[model samples]
Target: MPPPASSQSCAPAPAPAYRGRFAPSPTGDLHPGSLMAALGSWLLARGAGGEWLVRIEDLDPPREVPGAADRQLAALRAFGLHPDGPVVRQSERGDLYRRALDRLLADGHAFECHCSRADLAATGGIHRRCVATTRRPRPAVRLRVAPDARVAFEDLVRGPQVQDVGATVGDFVLLRADGYWAYQLAVVVDDAAQGITDVVRGADLLDSTGRQILLQRALGLPVTRHAHLPLVTGADGRKLSKSESARPVDPTDPLPALRRAWAALGQDPAALAGADRVTDLLPAARTAFRPQLIGRGDTAS
Candidate 1:
């Protein structure tokens, strides 16, 4: 059964003057890598005199850790990154996703896909066309990507970006066969519903930007400004993610982690050197943050 709706409704609301968000999944405790994303997004929003909201991307139940969402929120508060509005959880927004799927199906932008991973493995995992010989009771739904489908956008940090979505990823899934809402669909819908004006996240999600842009155009949703910060990587040059058991940040002593994340974003170290509290550190960091100074590539945590 779907979870009950959160305190806030998923219905589209009047666009805010300027809005940004830091959405985190409840797969584990807040780690240094995730902290960088949160801090980066918060700094961008506050620096621009915009509202920064928090959204819990708790859509995958099987992978979620119990109590992780509350812990993540508590840690953000400890770091003095408070949301301007009530926090929202994606698990409670099923109705919104369903409505989006219905619209896509009705318009012929999306179709039922019976292809499995194995069925498309020979084509490098790109779902170009249906290859399933036998149809399954539950089929994934995918957005139809045209042969000439292309998306081009200017990223605040990375500059000019372009992707041929049809050739690169083919017709991507909107609803998985496992009966779970795909991240691409949920994020695009929620961003529009929340009236997000800018999307500031890690560079790791850069590839997803084009796909999301396509979704925005297909749904007639406003395309938000994007800035992808440098990712925090481990000694092995791999991204330090929750799935890899990255060490969790200590909310009890947030200054050190906060400082590290600030440096990871390529801001000057002296900007937050004297800060002994999160309250003082955040304002100083926000004032000194320059998106142009943020470098591309992996930042060792």
Candidate 2:
């Protein structure tokens, strides 16, 4: 995060009102890096005078931690980032994803795949030769990315972006072979249903925007504006993630962690010194929010 702007010229564009969301998977407690994402999305939405919603992306039950969703929400409240609408859980929205998948299958946009992770890893994750019909009753479903098909979209912070989905990610999975909806499909459907206008999250997910865009187009749904913030990294130079043993943010005393997240976005935390509580600091932070100060790949160390 950058220093608080001294003049109006350095402020972020209070644009075309937004409906942003902070969707997180409940695999563990709210870690520091995850707090940055939560704060970034919350600030962006509040700054634009728009709605900020919360969605618990618990699609993969195998990875979800029991009671983690409620704990995550509690952490956000400790830092004063509350949602404008009812919180949504992806596990309860299977029917919506199934309906969307049915449409894609009916239109010949989606196909079944029996390839496993190990199988795709060997082929560089392209899955180019998996076109053969499923040998088993249960098979994963994948969206057919046309050869050399260029998917382009403007990222608010990263600028104009382009990617050849077929060459990069190949036929991406929409439904896993294990009877769970893939992140790509569930997120697209939920975002559309929730009327999410902007998506502000960690830069680690920047690459995923392209695939999500492809899904948006295939579903005939409007694509939302995206602004991926710089990721927070551990001392080892890798992203701070749950799987990496990243420490969870302190829920009992969230102020310090909240301040660190504020600074991580390149914002000057000193301005918030007088804010005795987290909720009190948010209004001013929202006003001082400047996404442009966030440089690409400027990971929080």
Clashes of each: 0, 6
Which digits, one per residue and each the tens of the lDDT, describe model 1 over residues 91-163? 8888889888888899999999999888998999898889997898999999999977889999998999998
On a 0 to 100 scale, what is the lDDT of residue 48 in model 2?
80
What is every candidate's alpha-carbon RMSD to the true fold? 2.3, 8.3
Q: Give the Cα error of residue 199 in candidate 1, in Å.
A: 0.7
TM-score to true structure, per model? 0.95, 0.90
Misplaced by over 4 Å in model 2 are 1-16, 117-122, 131-134, 243-245
Tell me the deviation in Å of residue 83 in model 1: 0.3
Looking at model 1, residue 216 earns an lDDT score of: 86
For model 2, the local distance difference test gives 0.81
How big is the RMSD of model 2?
Answer: 8.3
Per residue, candidate 2 scores C-alpha lDDT tens digits across 1-301 of: 2122221121122334688999999998899889999998888888787899899999988889999999999998888888987788887777678888888999998988887776667777787668343365798899988878788888877899898877888888999888988998888887887778899988878878888998888888888899988888887777888346478999888788988888898888777787777667787787777877776775644
RMSD of 1: 2.3
- Over 4 Å off in model 1, which ranges? 1-12, 242-245
Highest-scoring model, lDDT: 1
**lDDT (Cα atoms) of all candidates against the true structure:** 0.88, 0.81
